[model samples]
Target: MLGTRVSAFLKLSKRDLKYDLPASIVVFLVALPLCLGIAMASGAPLFAGVLTGVIGGIVVASISGSALSVSGPAAGLTVIVLGAIQQLGAYETFLLAVVLAGVIQLVLGVLKAGMIGNYFPSSVILGMLAAIGITIILKQIPLAFGMTETHAFEVEDGGGIAAFTNTIFSSINWGATIICLLSLAVLIFWPSFKKLSKIPAPLIVVILGVALGFAFQGTSFALNPDHFVSIPVVSSFAEFKGLFIFPDFTQIVSKDVWVVAFTIAIIASLETLLSIEAVDKIDPFKRNSPTNRELIAQGIGNMSSGLLGGLPLTSVIVRSSANANSGGRTRQSAILHGIWLLVALLAIPTVINLIPLAGLAAILLHTGFKLAKPALFKQIYKKGLDQFIPFFITVAAVVFTDLLTGVGIGIVVATFYILKANMTNAYQFNIVQKEEADMAVLTLAEEVTFLNKAPIQQKLYNLPKGVKSVVIDGHKSKFIDKDVIDVIKDFEQNALSKGLSIELNDVTYKQKPLNGNFRLKKQKLQKVV
Candidate 1:
């Protein structure tokens, strides 16, 4: 079996080289600016983002079962990373949390917890995503317009709309704003052209920004050096090696570290699982990836990233879709993209430094807009109050508080709705007191749980006075809770005293199975008359 597996992999690699090679380059181009932008958004060293891309592409891709999924630093985690860094007091301390988070992910993979992603309510998940998008947009606004002294998250003196408007208008740098607007234009409209669609818009944005940066040099409109990406420029192998920052292991005992670790592990795992699931749906081969193995790969990738002073990483749908659209058919494309990232980081630091932060900001802004599109709100609202309420609440909570807290609140609200529905739909009770017949019928739903017991009991005891016969039907029920069964038994015992005849329709009981499982016994119609 091992030999056959190896043979098949080798064959796939050889057959897909023509397609994978170009796809790898496209994915590399697509991942480049994103790595720097997400790292900037995360408030980590720019090099950390590149390192994550390298590790995700090379490490995760190597171990992952997914053929086309690409792993890298993602925008979704920027909010968590930013908050954790501030809360932990140091980047090194945050790194320790990242390392521990990876260990947690490894345990989860071993426990086959990949299915946990499916348990999160869809509305809550969508709300979380939309919240992240809004946060990213808010965070990038200052960068996009080249506001130097004012950080996006900072509070101004006498904070209000007037102060914000005055600060923003006064601090706006026309040079950076021009580049940002141009980049946004390309991102929004580039795909409309058939030929230009093949070239990634981000690559074009970077090139345009760099050219404009140089063009404005020595002029009044010249951008500050801080307006561009600032990765360390290393002259020797020793210098390159020294650039990597290690985690402060001494901080391991801090409670904040564990909280940050758990948060990162869960959010990263969820994003990875969701991304891979989406990638599989779009795969031309329609292949299903082993989610457990993907989690294991991501665990290893994140561990390597933490050790190397890199940002947390996950399977990114943006890069994966780019890979697929560019004809990538195997994991080779992802691995090769990592190699390109490493080579660029080592060899072309000068070229990369020329790319403006404003352009990267525009890219992130575009990503944010996609995540929180108005259409998404309309769609969720159309799903009804049960969905929209939780979704809207989650959005508000995340915006006001944090990701984990918001999701918890959303889950609680969603659970309440679920219980309410269960209580109301447990069974259908109807009464017919006509001259021809005075009969009442109680029909059990497909599955009845203990939550249904109260309503069932109340309805059973409150039947109309003129009813001559009462029928309890379970023909459609596959499973009935023991509590509900007890209620039925009690009703049977009291029916005679109420001067009503009792009948059971396809409702029978049997001993619990030998294996200690309780299953509803399906028998012919049983009567208790």
Candidate 2:
């Protein structure tokens, strides 16, 4: 079985090499800055993010059932990681939590809890993707303006609007800003020419920024070292080995550790499921990824990451979407990107450290714009209030609050509309006036439950005195609740006192012997006045 799986994978990789190869390069370029940034934001060692990216790509991609999704240290988990690190009192202790989280995810996958992702409304999911795009744009703005990580941190701590204003007004690197603008221009227009499309725009952006970085050196507009990607350069294998920080197993019994572990597991799993769902929607092939297998893959990746001193990882939409947009056709792109990350980190760290953060920021900025485009908003609005309200509220909530909280709120709103629709559409009522006598027609819907009993009863009890006959039709109903049937029977009894003729069409009650419960069953139409 294992050999067959390997053979199938090799065949797929070979078939899509042309598409996956360049796409992997694009994903690698995109993943680089994000991995570092999420690590910095999480208050962990910068190499931790690179480690997560490597493991997620090589380990998780090999095990996952998804074709295009990529995994890495996610920006969404930064707040939780930062807090967990502080609470645990050491970075090593937090790694223990990450491992425990992986175990929990494995259990969840085994229980088939991945199906929970299917319950999320499409509107809420779309809103979540849009909100993430907006957040990415907001976060990358300072970097695009040639600001330092310190300045970006200030924006994060100070509130997005006020802090962003102060940071941008206080300092600006003209060199980095110029390069960022040039990079954005290249990204915006590069895909327009079909012939040059195979060469990823992000690569050209990096090359342009690197060339400009050299040209502006020693000048007044020169970029500060802080504006460039910073990876610690190691001269020997021993030095590189020294960078790895193992988890502290001594903290395994700590209650705080378990709490952090559960938090990470649930949040990471949710984010991974949501990311894959979004990626599948945009896939040209419209393939359905196996969610349970994805959870298992993520669980193994997180365990390996924690064991080797890396941040927790999840399937990241930013990188995955980039892969898809770049024409990635299979999981090979994700795996290859991880290999590139490992190679770059070990072989030429200095060269990578020289790439300006502004260029990467430009790439992310373009990606963000595509996600939250005005066309998407207009399209959702056209889907009607039922879809638009939940979608809009979800976008607003996610922007103002955290992702999980926002999605939860959106789900509540969507569920409310669903219940409202079910209540209002319980049945169809119409009145007809004939020369001899007026008649009323009441048709039951596909499914009638206890919640619909009040409305159905109300309509029948309030019938006009001039109506001499009433018809209750259940031919279209597949499932009719006992409460609804009781309502109909009581109304018929009430009608007898008013000298009204009543007719029943294809409705009867069936009692279950095991549970002593009853259900409405179809029967021959009958009349009883």
Candidate 3:
């Protein structure tokens, strides 16, 4: 049975490999620059990002059920990792947090806590995507202009907007600028050629960048060495092991370690879940990735990465979208991409370094445009204030602050909208004309909660003294909050004294079944009139 299963698996792998191979190469190329860029942004070792990409691909993909979702070191976690590393004052200590974070995620997956991601409001999620998009553009501006020594990535720590501006003004390399614009143009207009669907724009951009790098060599227009990728060349197995940094177990008892651990776990898991959801939406097959399983895979991936000196890893949308767009059909593409990363880092680091950073910046700039597309903004605006407010605020907050803080702000805004909608839709109080006089009707909605109490109370207290009759009916309500019931009870108890006659009928369906679907449910209330 084992032999037969292995044979069938190999057969399927082979079929997938054919289509996935090309897609994996695209993902690898996209992932390579992002890994290095994010690692630099995070203030960690450059190789840590490559290590993360390798682990995300080989370990995470092997365990994850997501077909086309690619995992890797992400830009979203740059802020978190940077702060944690600075706070801990040591990279090895930070590794302990990454490992602990994996444990937390593992527990969450086992407990099915992955469902927490489902509760995040869509407006906030869209806002997050937009915020990251805008942040990407802002961060890439310096790089695209060849401001290589500006140290703008540190702005995520506490530098804020002013530091980023300083970076742009301080340095400018015209040679890098020329190449960056050329690469951006290719990325922007390359999609018009439908015949080039199989060949990605990023690949072309990189090739053009390498060609530019060589062109500029030993000439008046020669670009600085910093303009190119600076991946450390690992020549042999002996040197490879030296690159890996082990976690400091001694820091495990420190509260900072535990705190940062949970922080990374929550943020990384959230990023992973959001990325998986976004990738699944774009999947041509429309296949659903199991959320809980993805979390577990991510947990293991992070743990493995931490042990081997890597930055945090997650399901990365930029790479996954690149994979899906490149015709990848299965998880093999993701795994193969990781293997490719490992092979490159171990064998051809020098060749990889030939590509220019400006070229990568162009690609990211293009990605930023896609994420913060004008059409997306217009679409959200058309959805009305409820959606736009949170989305816009989230984007603004993320740009001003960091990722987690901005997400918190967006969630708060989103929650406010939820409360607003709930309050508005909870119930209704209207005065209708009757044969003799005006009859006030308090029609309860599907569900009325304590949140609806203030408005409902105000409406009841101002129930025109001239009213002859008032009906407090919840005959159709699925659920009536106790506070609402008490408010109605108090008003009814005083109705007779106020020269009003009140008729109170079924206020809740707590015990009595409705629509032959719900069990017996009813609200208990004593009638005063």
Candidate 4:
């Protein structure tokens, strides 16, 4: 009986692992450099990136709703992290913020705020993605030129042009620069080489760069070792001892910690939600992800990351998209990707150390270019100015300011545009009831939200002065927000003075008022009805 059970379990595991193993390996190849780069960007220890990858894969993957989406430390948080570290006064304090942030995320998931992600317009999503791509490209330029530590303007920092100019004026690492250019050339032209067309270009570039590093190690032709990958040197478990740094619980009482904690939670939630939405759109199977479940998975992953002295993790689109494009079809791919990080960090640190920073930069640069491609802008333009304007604004704002700030600006602008567009064709108040009739019937459209409140309020206020009954026909309305319900409550109170009776038709109040009024209470959707 024991052997039978063991055999059954093994078969199940094998069945689940088969196709995803190869894809997971591919994803691992892509995730490693990104993990290192993002960790460096976030002002965290290099191993923090590996920790995030592991937790995201082995822990988060076990609970995440997404089948293909991968989570880990993100480059998007680089500026936030740098600022947090500076403000918090110590890495340990910042880690406390991370832990608190995870707790906040867990609360959000419990409250099911994940539905908020559904409200963001597709245009804004596309624009944000494009901006991220541009930022990646701009940020990688210095590394591509083997100019780490040389401050340059980056797209994310809104210094792309300035950075490019500065790099041009500085002394160049000609050998590393040549390799970067050559790698780009091969990536662009390798498809022409019929036999090599199917090869993963980035892997090839990395291999070549590493080989060159070894070949020229002892000669005048050698590139500076500092420009190469810098995995921490460890001889034993004790040497790897300080890799995990716990958060300082002493900061738990500080207001600043709470502030940073909430900020991290809100931003991380937004990023994760957006990433999940985007990943779902790209999923070939078109399976929708459970947003709340994703939030929970992220919360757990981040909590673990924070507890272990690692940076926060989120559903990063770049890595997730890379995994999907590489043919990953299951959670095992994500889990395996994490396993690769562990193996590389522990067993192959020397080989990783040989990879040139310039090569990795080249990979990021290529990715960035793909994101900011002119074709995407043209496509947005074709969708109409409503789409193009918001997208452009989002890109510009994100590039000039910061991620959250940029998104806020975009949301405000998009809201105004939406209001303006809706106002023109909003509810038309046509009285269907005759003067002799006791009831005045008003039919609402397919949907109504706070934006329609003004028009609705105006229609209710101007009700023919003598109508005995006011019937709101919401049978056609699919959904109504609390603001509109509040307007209705106010209308109900005033209806007594106007000698009119207000009645809701085919509409059940989804929420109850806090004070026994008709005001809609905040509640979760229990069913479609």
Candidate 5:
């Protein structure tokens, strides 16, 4: 009987609703606190975060090609959003920045710049993940300890880390702390069987947290108002309509507006692209998402979010990973999560407020551990120094500075190693000194750039001064920069004076010297002994 009902439902749902329905509920639970927390951290209205969640679910997921990635406002963007909000001085003015950011992202997609995502070094991306993880763990520590008045403003100059550190330890509530610790225990130690996960650990955390809140009521261990989630209550649809604030076009001319817009667009796009790459690696189905289309979908979502008075949105890895872990099988799971958020707002605003902030903190703390797991470092170290240095530097820089700045520093470090590799191993040099046939074979790398010039020149200079024959081989090379080729030609012209006969094999010469009428004295091609 049940089998027949399931079959009929599967036929009605294209066989996806079964997987998507429960997963959507799980994603909604995961997104709820994150959305509220991010909004609080960004200094935006609480409702704005929820609104972004809806758009990311319904709008971005509907258009995105990714099967598992969930779009919403990200913790990674919190610092930037915080600074932008303070500078703009008005939520509506900040909304203008958000709208402009969406436009810029749309232009980036139109220009086919999604391929830019491919250029980021793995070391840098890993560094970003680690840095954000560390930030989350540290930022949530106080909240988990039941220390209210904890905010995520940057540990900036004149204020430094001390000021931020002092703020967290001032007011401590034992009840919130106990609930948080117990909630983390459940999430961490609960049976992780595939069937067991259907009852998401986070949902359990919220339930327990709310029960704790009520159980300790009228006691010394009672939860503080600051320690609980608070959602605004609206009496009617018109009052709900009054909550949204639109963008201010009048501020569009301001340079700060444009600057913040560009900053948000670039960082948001980079984060989105990185998240897409990260999610694809973990996907059980091994599907690849079209990066360009993701940017376009995100752009549209951000535009809608801005117009609706919400924070900027991106494809967040945290929510997406949760969805995947919860057995979400389609994009329908993500879209349905948004619908859940919308439905909850219209029906259960009071119920949401009963969720403890501590419970949400526990969920994020678990996420933080996953992001910067100790095993990740051990794995990167096994790859050796050429990979580890850039990865470590990226992590340190991101933790100390911001994401964009850390990535910049990491890319520079990665580039240095690349240049060093080119300089040291640009080509292989071998000397064959058979009686009467003394030949030096120079085999160029597949792609020899100008960075390889110095080493190639040095090898040529160090060649046996009395060798009678030399072979500069490019048979395996796909590209040889003009400067490198010029060095070879220059050495060829200069070699004849030392009683050396030259043979150039499979070389593509490109330059002004090669362009003008030029003829080689000998047309011999050399073969390796």
Candidate 6:
């Protein structure tokens, strides 16, 4: 019996691990550099990136709903995390926020809040993604030039336009700068050559950058630890003792921890949802993820990450898309990527350190350009003004403010436009009666939204003074908003007082009526005549 069960489990596992091993290797190669870059961006210890990638792939992938989605340290969370670290005053304290954030995410999953992802307009999502791409390119420029001095931004200088400009001008490492330009050239034109097109340009660029760094090591050019890939020092198993930093339990009493916790939960959930949607669009297999399950997976992964002295993890679009493009067919690629990180970290720290930071920047810059290409903007514009307007607004907001703030602004603008469109053509009402028992009926038009509140209110107010029975028929209406339901509730109250009857028909959950009649069926009228 034991042998039978073991064989069954192995068969299922093998089925899940169907991606070509070569593709998995490519994904791992791509993921390693990004893991370090994102960790650096977040102002966390460099190992934090590797740790996140390992957990996201090995631990999170084991439980995730997405088959091809990859998770790791994300650039999107950099700003919030940096601020949290500064505010919390220590990495350990900040870890407390991460743990609390995990708990909050779990609660959201239990409540099925992942459904919120379905409402985001596709145009807005594309714009936000493009904006993020542009931001990554701009932010990495300084690092590419080997400028590490501008790393610290005082509390007063705020992190938008001014700080970015200062960082650009104040420190520029010429050696790294030249390498970046060369790397960009290779990435752009390498695809034109049929013989080289199949090769990974970024990996090639990294190799060249590393060679250049070695050549310039003792000459006029010198590369500091900050300008090269950082491999955490682990002399032995005992030296790995500091790998996991525990959060201070005392932070639980502080209000600030809760604030950070909620922020992480909300932002993490939003990013995860958006990434899942984007990944599905790119998947050749067209597998739909169970959103609630995804939330739970992220929650568990993040909780584990925090407890293990790592940063928060989320389903990141860039890595997930890369996995898809690299011919990853199943969850095995993600899992293998994590396993690779662990193996590399333990077996080849010295070799990993040989990779130059400029090389990684080159790869990222190429990625950024792809994301923010002019063709994308044109495509979005062609979709129509309703789509274009919200998209542009989201891009501008994200460029000017931080990620959450920018998305919030886009949500508000989109909501306003949506409400405006709904209000203009929202309502028409008709009254009818049946002669069998003098039944009065109210028929609503094809659409009724919260914006139709005024019309619904007026109709109820001017209801016939002598009507003894009334029914609201929404059979023809495709949608009914919450405001109309509130109006119905008010009508129900007044009808009872005036010896009239009331009934509702053809209401639906999708229409979101104000009353708890989400799935309630049409019922016979109660007469008061």
Residue 461 CA error for candidate 4 (Å)?
17
What TM-score number comes out for model 3?
0.87
Clashes of each: 0, 0, 8, 2, 0, 1
Model 2, TM vs. native? 0.92
Candidate 4 or 1, higher TM-score: 1
Which digits, one per residue and each the tens of the lDDT, describe model 5 over residues 1-529?
Answer: 9977854532325577888887888789879878988998899988999999999999898888889999999988998899999898988999999999999999888888888888887877887777777878887887787876534334455465677666444456778888989999988876466677667677788889999999989998898787877767788989999989999999989999999999999999998998887777668898989999999999999999999999999999879877887688878899889999888788988898888888888887887788889999999999888889999999899888877788889999999997897788878998887787678888888778888999999989887745678888887776677798778878877887766778888864433455687432322234322
lDDT of 5 at 214: 98
lDDT of 1 by residue, 1-529 (tens): 9977965753446778887887887688668878987898899988899899999998899889999999999877998899999999999999999999999999999999887666677788778778867877887788888985646434558778877777667678889999999999998899899887777776788889999999999987799988987666788999889779999999889999999999999999988886776577568998988888888999988899998899889998778877876679999999999999999889988887788889888877887787788999999999999999999998889788776678789889998888989999988888867685689999999888889899999998888777888999998888777788889888887987776788988754444988998665876444866
Model 2: residue 392 alpha-carbon error in angstroms: 0.7
Residue 367 in candidate 1, Cα distance off native in Å: 2.2
Question: Predictions ranked by TM-score, top down?
Answer: 2, 3, 5, 1, 4, 6
The CA lDDT of each predicted structure is 0.84, 0.90, 0.85, 0.77, 0.84, 0.77
* Candidate achieving the largest lDDT: 2
**TM per candidate:** 0.81, 0.92, 0.87, 0.75, 0.85, 0.74
Specify the highest-TM-score model's number.
Answer: 2
Model 5 C-alpha RMSD to native = 5.5
Measured on C-alpha atoms, candidate 1 has an lDDT of 0.84
What is the per-residue lDDT of model 3 for residues 220-330, given as tens digits with 9 covering 90 to 100? Answer: 668887888878897678988899999999988999999999999998998888777767766899998888999999999999999989998999987887788778999
Local accuracy of candidate 2 as per-residue lDDT tens digits, 1-529 = 9988885764455779899998999899999989988999899999999999999999999989999999999988999999999999999999999999999998889888899888899999999989988998998888898877563436556576777777766687888889989999999899899999778898899899999999999997798888899877888999999999999999899999999999999999999999989899889999999999899999999999999999999999999988998899999999999999999999989999889999999999998888899999999999999999999999999999988899999999999998888888988988898999999999989888888888898899888778889999988888777788888878878888778899888764454657777654576545785
Off by over 4 Å in 4: 1-19, 151-170, 189-199, 215-221, 427-529
> What are the candidates' C-alpha RMSDs?
4.6, 3.4, 4.9, 7.8, 5.5, 7.7
